[model samples]
Target: MQQIFDFKALVKYRDRAAQRLGTVTPVLEELTDRLLDRLDDTTSRFSTALDFGGRGVLAPMLKARGISVDSADFSALLAAKAGGTPLPLPGPADFKLTQARYDLIVAPLSLHGLDDLPGALIQFRRALKPEGLLLASLPVLGTLHELRLNLLETEETLTGKVSPRISPFPELRDCAGLLQRAGFTHPVADIEELEFLYANPLALLHELRDAGEGNALCARSRAIPPRALFPAALAAMPRKEGRMVARLRMAVLTGWAS
Candidate 1:
């Protein structure tokens, strides 16, 4: 399969950022909290849980809830930060999940980067015990739409062509289908749209960088974008209350391992 993302580079970038900043993305943290809240409402008690690609957020929360939690991530630095076992989980093709190891598996803001999402979902299903729960939060298709549009229009106006500047995310219905394809029962996918205000477009870009959410597409432009591109894009962005606004639509998916 063709590699769509520079997964290793992503891991290295995230690790370095974590080492330097020691901060979590605000939106991601919020999303994780929401997912955990849903888990809390569940009547089923999970004895063993896997915080898959959660960057350590879910594990400690699960532990606090008296569930035995283990975490896995592609970035060793992130894993260490989360106090988890380091696992180089680049994609579904590299998955080596042990059968029926977890009663609950949760992945927060991680599945959108996978090259083989369906395969990953299948692996999650296989790794879970019967009636086990699977929950995942992924950026939906409309995430960063404004940024994508502004960048594309700016590039097209300047260079007469556009380059890939954002990662393509899955749609909500597609996520539901993936869960069903993975043989999970009672699949559910819901969207949560979040709007954030930034001082300027540069701030928004910086936030994405700080969150380790840079462009990782194989087809992404290697050359630096023109200096005027950003300013122009910023000027073009819609302002609300004197601040630039960015929107992110996150898809939360849940299912039961049958």
Candidate 2:
């Protein structure tokens, strides 16, 4: 697959966050809760599951339902923190899984950073037992738009050069199409718009780093940016009720393994 995100960087950031972050990011916790809630709508009882990218939220929930779960993440520490044996990512876009092994696979707010998202989806589908369920969510097009725009404008004003700061995310309309392309049955996709608030722009940045959601685009420059860049850019975001607001357009996706 063509390069997109730096997978190793992603792992490092996640592991660091696992070591240092004291609490869960509200957005992550909310998304995890929302994804698990989808399980309630399904009549089929799942016996086994894979908790991909859960931040100490999903494994407990699935176990509570008496479903045995295996947790996997690029970061081993992250998987351990999620309360399951760590299944590490073998490569940027490739991993081996036993075919027809799981009753359910829940990959929330993950997969978007992958260089080969379609390939990863196909693997997830292949790992499911017959009629198994795949429920996932990812940051779609409007996510982080406020911060992205402000950063771009800030960089342009100071350096007169454009840089790829924010990673590209999938679009909502095409999410279902992705599932179809990966050969999933009964594919469906929908959007959930969420808003979060922070005290200031720096607080927003801090939360992002603490959540291990820092920029991992392969095209991102390694050189240190202007000292004033972040301060100026984040300060420019529009505030609501005296708090800086961040919007997340999440594409909640579902499919069945045939």
Candidate 3:
């Protein structure tokens, strides 16, 4: 996709980081708790679940709830590192979905990485049973708007090339529409905006790298030549209250089979 920046290596990097972190952030942990809180425990037969971005955090929760979860990821590295089923992204949902035979599916910050997000959602819907539930949390539109704006301004003024260094996340409306278009019933979506204060751009970049949220769009160029453009672009960004604030927008989406 045109919006993808350094897609291949970036995904690989994320997989590695996931292996290292082995724990979910407070934000994601909270989201997972909410999703789990909404789970219907009336049916003990439907105890099998699937974790799409399961780096290892939700495993304990699912186990505690007596639910067996099949953790999956497109990254062979992540899957192997995390020691679970390794699956391809957005292909052959029937095969994987059947293999797992899950009644609940959870994807935390995983859907946005797909190039064909709409198609992937369709696959997720197909993977579910009539009474199955699908839950996903992804960064949507308005995410990192400040960083994007600053990068654009910097590129325009320095290199005259606005290299979008981030993935194109879908908006909350688009995400809900995608669930419906993919044939999900009772689709619900909520937008959550998080503002993180950074000491500077370098610090922000470091956090992004550690979080594995750095650029991964394949269409993007990853070359950085040693020239005045680099410094000039960095200088173009503005400081806010003596610090830089980057705003991130994430959407929590849930749906059920019809």
Candidate with top lDDT is: 2
Please give, for residues 66-118, the per-residue lDDT of candidate 1 as tens digits: 88776777776666666455555554475777899999998988777778888
Tell me model 2's lDDT, rounded to 2 decimals. Answer: 0.85
**Global lDDT for candidate 3?**
0.66
Q: Higher lDDT: candidate 1 or 2? A: 2
Off by over 4 Å in 3: 1-7, 22-31, 34-46, 81-95, 225-243
- For 103-132, candidate 2 gives per-residue lDDT tens digits of 899998878778888888999999999899
TM-scores, all candidates, are: 0.93, 0.96, 0.80
Top TM-score prediction, candidate number: 2
As for TM-score, the candidate ahead, 1 or 3, is 1
Tens-digit lDDT string for candidate 3 (42-145): 34355777777665566556777777766776665565544344554433223255622667787877677666677677777677777788888888888876
What TM-score does model 2 achieve against the real structure? 0.96
Q: TM-score rank, highest first?
A: 2, 1, 3
| Global local distance difference test of model 1 | 0.80
- Sliding window of 10 residues with minimal summed lDDT for model 3: 91-100
The residue pairs that clash in candidate 2, if any, are none
lDDT of each: 0.80, 0.85, 0.66
